[model samples]
Target: MEEKSGSLVEWLAPLAFILCAGWLTWHLPAFTLSWFPPKDPSQYDKLSALFARIDVTDSMTGLFGGYADAVDWAALLLLPVFGIIGVRTVRRAPMEFESWKPLDRLAVFIGRLTMMLIVLLCSVMIYEVILRYVFEAPTLWANELSLWLAGFVFLCAGLYAMQQRSHIRIFLLYDMMPRWLQRVCDIISTTLIVTFAFFLVYGGYGEAFDKFYRWETFGTVFDPPIPATLKPMVLLVMVLVAFQAIVNLISDWNAEPVIHTAADDIDQDELDRLRAAVGADGTGDLDVTRGSIQSNTPGKS
Candidate 1:
């Protein structure tokens, strides 16, 4: 039991790290959700005064700070949510798969990759802080470095998320259907996801290829290649995601619905003991009394 619980933790820790990294990304200004006021001008105080007055109508113009213009920061919030949710999905135990073996190995590998990206991102910021503030010399490559990391995380994690059953699904209608119909719906949905992913891969490859051909750069001191180096990853991961979706569909098709028993929602120890008494291992591999465990919810066992 200790070994089993430790195994579960091993699967969960990397996911938890990714979730924290995502939360930080969401709240941090580096991601651009936070704002910084610009250099002050004579109009700045006047604009500030106007902003203070409730009767003013040009709040939009007045809100424009710094040398340029103001923009909405709401979209930045989605980045973190996507990251966290993707990691969470990857971290979850595959109650859907009975024996850990190869399936569990794949999930763990994906989790580790996600965690590595998160750590690398954090390391960059730490380096930025030490060099920019401590050494009093800022690196122009910081922004480019961060963006590159973000792109990799986003693309690679999408595949991992799909494998973990963490992607969004509208199952309200399917949940109400009969078992056979539910399987049918699963088939249809799986087919559509594969089709969409295939097209995305095809289109994204062309787009990325063009960008690479253009020799695009960030136009900064570092002059890092923009959308050129990362383009292939975009197409690659999409293809990987499509492949994973295919595997998922095949797995689901072969898998029987979970079987629930008197110990269905009970504690693991109690469930184990009960199963032992019933001459079953509760591992979903043996048929002691009945042929199989009744399907209740996925990934619970």
Candidate 2:
């Protein structure tokens, strides 16, 4: 029963995100209009008129420009899916060369999501091109949506880099250090990361909250709440990165040092597989040729 439940959750998580993503893509135009509906007679004064007309404090018909905001609903729906996946990931033991922690899993998921957004970004750009050149009708939302998704992609990529241990490090002198010294270096590096994350969250909290509370919009025709959403997201992901660094440091503290030499660099298993595939005898070509040469030499009867 437990196993079945776990499997169900695993299956449901990605399905939920996929369905929500598709729904958002389908209704993107409607959501964009909700934030910035068409106005009559005055282009510049439209936002002012919108604010005057819709009471920002009203919960049912206001905040986020009212119930017409389909984007918010899509986001809300995805929250639980992500939450389930995150919990499951964190509960699992760490894998070799892969952190099975919630932070790593979340970063990976966000990375994949960023890829999906790239598809959406390309689609929007292509659509905009066809509209502009072929139909001579350009959209105001396409560029802004692309920019929004690109920002998220870059942010998510930072987290993914941390998870993969692919971020820049000066390993020249560090590689030569003793294991104890290496562990000390790891501690110091992780401490610095944690400190930076702490400060970011501490200093940026008020601004993030303010933007979110006001449901601040970009004032453009599309009127995305980029600042409100992205500021908090950046700080949150940085915190996750800091935690991952700490986790890595602890996990690797007792690990054996990996020394790389020319002989050790070659993958012998891969060579053996290649030799097997080519139907070579157990001995290599060089050895066989040398044996043949020795046998054919003049002296021996």
- Highest-scoring model, lDDT: 2
Residue-by-residue lDDT tens digits, candidate 1, 70-130? 3223324444554444344443343433323344345545656666787878889889999
User: Model 1 misses residue 203 by how many Å?
Assistant: 2.7
Candidate 2 residue 297 Cα shift, in angstroms, is 28
Query: Candidate 1: worst 10 consecutive residues by lDDT?
Result: 25-34
What candidate 2 gets wrong by more than 4 Å, as runs, is: 1-15, 18-78, 85-96, 259-301
lDDT of 2: 0.63
Q: How many clashes does the backbone of model 1 have? A: 8
Residue pairs in candidate 1 whose N, alpha carbon or C atoms collide under 3 angstroms? 38-66, 95-299, 258-294, 258-295, 259-293, 259-294, 259-295, 260-294
For candidate 2, the C-alpha RMSD (Å) to the true structure equals 9.0
RMSD of each: 17.9, 9.0
